[model samples]
Target: MTDLTIRARIREASNATFLADLDGEAVVYKPVEGERPLWDFPDGTLAGREVAAFLVSEAFGWSVVPPTWLGDGPFGPGMVQRWQDIDPEQDAVDIVAPDVAEAPDSGWLPVLEAIDEHEQPVTLVHEDTEQLRRMAVFDTVVNNADRKGGHVLAMPDGHRYGVDHGLTFHVEHKLRTVLWGWIGEPLTPDELEGVDRVSEALRGDLGRALEEHLTPQEIDTLGARCAALRAVGIFPPPPGHGPAVPWPLF
Candidate 1:
């Protein structure tokens, strides 16, 4: 659906969430509070979080969750979004085992590893590593600050999808995530094509419409990321360094 076409009723949600029902379908919402421990962060973090997820999803032509509406919030009126039905067991695929610790590579590990809560296991099995790498690219493009191990999900059919984008789009370059499989590797030809399609889409009406919701700096940064990815021909080296990987999956 178009970004503007998603309709959901805004209900009362906790600081971490803005509750809403998507088109009278299942429940759909986004966390209102950007990320916990907000002392050192940026503005519009809450909105930026959801927007970043949607932007990345659209750019890559995936079913990325979108913010449906806007309403009054603890900080003020913010965007409303459709909530994803995360089956605790089914959704998570990359989280590593916690109690038993790191065993053989037969299980999923936490791909997004910095979340405050514990709901899924994040591990890096041999099969899921490549998908994790692709997700890392999407995270970098959006500047998502919180790509915890548990945020990456495995659909029943084994397709991986990234979620929980509440900390994104800071003025700073604080891109953190757990998928380090491609740190030194280059982008594949198909991956490069995906980046080009996204870049082209951004320059069209989609980017102009998104500009209304995103700040000038944020929008420009999005463009810059697309351009950079197209030219890099490879993943390139990590620019700023804090931690390329996320926290412990287990």
Candidate 2:
């Protein structure tokens, strides 16, 4: 076990978040005691949910979410995750509101159009990349409730990392995200294979690991989602009633 030590506090987060060192490695720490209570999720369970997201990502053989684990920190028990340094110059996912008459050529997918502060129309756009598509698939399987654009981290090496996965794995459906570009698209053969791997893992080791963090019902529902997605073989559309997109998208 690595010895984790708090180095600094991250003030930008809604809840208490810390920057720490684990066995000489830099990591972000989110203590359960510092988590704000949510009406939907049980009290002090957000940290566990974050780790659960990591476990699911690893199971899929998709390193979309950063490496995370449950451990003791300066603030008590919490989730510790390896820090990913994002490239400042380029963003894998970005918002573009070009003032041109017609939309730009290709590579971008329009998410929504809104009126700017100047009353001019603006269009929100994200890159059409395989990395982002994988993340969207991961979000669906994990039942990620909050997938704001800001949560996507673009590495200098072209790899994308996702963070802040505290709201996930609800027994009831809850998948709020900004990645609607691939909605209704058929899952690739590799993606389907990943889903199958997860389904099998959930019946064994992954299930046991999650049981320590989540309720039995939540784990069961997670397996059911895997089966349903495999059966459908298509990216699902947002539910009819609730909000499918997250607020403050970036």
TM agreement with the true structure for every prediction: 0.68, 0.94
lDDT of 2 by residue, 1-250 (tens): 3478889999988899999998888999999889999999973388998998999999999899899998988778888899988899876656656653135565777667788788877776667788888898899999999999889998998888999999999988899988888778899998999999999999899999998888988899999999999999998989887988888888
Point out the worst 10-residue segment of candidate 1 by lDDT. Answer: 1-10
Which 10-residue window in model 2 sums to the lowest lDDT? 95-104
User: lDDT per model, in order?
Assistant: 0.58, 0.87
Show the colliding residue pairs in model 2: none
Residue-by-residue lDDT tens digits, candidate 1, 70-155: 54443344555555555565633343455432455644443333233465653443234556556767777777767765667665
Which candidate number maximizes lDDT?
2
Candidate 2 vs. true structure, TM-score: 0.94
